[model samples]
Target: MQTQVRVRGARRWIMFGAIGFGALFLVVGLILAGVSVSFLANAERARGTVVALEWRNDHNGVSRKNRENDEPVAYPVVEFTSADGTQRSFRSSTGSNPPSYEEGERVEVLYRADSPEDARIKGFASLWLLPLIFGGIGLGIAGVGTVVALATRGRS
Candidate 1:
């Protein structure tokens, strides 16, 4: 005799959750891919002067050698005013290879005037890299989840 498995409403919900996570991962992955491509495609256009720079480390992005004694590092926020007279702020993560400009400096920034809030500093490739990395992971997971769901469908 073979072992039997049944999927009730709750189990179905569990499956739904797994699939939902995969779907969400894919969606987010796509969005990140777009952003990454845009950034790469229009790197020159993303250039902007450094208007305001602030530190934001609510998530503690920095640390010392041990990563234990280091305090919560904040980010460097640079606000820029596009040619259209609109101002936007871009955050520089502590771990990023690029360094943020000092206050009232003319620094190059890569960003979409439409959503300047999501941008990276001129020297920072982290912004562009992150999306690709995240998208790859997301898409890969989504693919695996899809395959699993299909394989275990009615039998679930």
Candidate 2:
């Protein structure tokens, strides 16, 4: 009886963990999706003047194999002045493809002023991509949690 109780407790903990993870993912996804939508709606968006551009050797999986071959890859990046008249720097990401311009090139972008990291240099902030991925994971977790919770509730 004691062994059975311990096993049930462990299962209960697993269910709780699943629900927790699911809720977290869902919340984060919804927030990101909301931000992306808002950025898309803005008129002026994140228009800026490119002041600088450069590349650094920050290792990534895409370049991991090349790193072993002594390959020095140049990552395109841009620094620009926001509408607020403040200068900041942003590097390109896989999410935003086809970098718009080079250093000293004036460009228009749509990014969150407060969090420049959450930005789309060429277009609107497409935070939706991450959110959608997370949301799908959340749904999967939620479904599993629901099943476990249902299955364990009566027995415990």
Candidate 3:
């Protein structure tokens, strides 16, 4: 029947979509992981202090229950002395709703010799979280696609 044929086609499309999206995520995750690894390998480590927390309004429009009373996120500004004894500071790209660090807190910093201004606070959240999330989602999506494909093939 034409209806049965259309159903099969639709299922096939869904399977392909899942696999395609999964592969995309997997590739991105791999690339990000690679970059993180490279950075870690080449970066110079130093002790630093949290000098200040820069507050900014959440513009990403993540809805909160008390939208009008939304508090600003806090991004830490770290100050560190490079190997060559030059003073440097950089604001962290990641932020938290509740302040994650207090001013005067000591932390480890990772930076490149060439560009110490683009330094990062060395932590799992700063580096590994994104790649892990993407890779996990990719694997789950690809697994679902594989299951659907196998089921459809069996029915055929």
lDDT of each: 0.59, 0.65, 0.91
Ranking by lDDT: 3, 2, 1
TM-score against native, each model:
0.47, 0.57, 0.90
* Best-fitting candidate, scored by TM-score: 3
RMSD of each: 6.5, 5.8, 2.4
Per-residue lDDT for 31-91 in model 2, tens only? 8788667776763455556554444555566566666544333434556566677766666
Candidate 2 wrong stretches, greater than 4 Å:
43-56, 59-90, 93-108, 111-119, 122-125, 154-156
Per-residue lDDT of 38-154 in model 3, one digit per residue for the tens? 999999999999999999987676678657767888999999999999999999987887888899999999999999987999988788988999988998898899888998788
Give the Cα RMSD of candidate 2: 5.8
**Model 1 TM:** 0.47
Clashes of 1: 3
lDDT of 1 by residue, 1-156 (tens): 122334355555665676677677667767876866777676534345655445433434543453653343334566666656676676675332133355566666766655656667766345555665666766676676677667767565
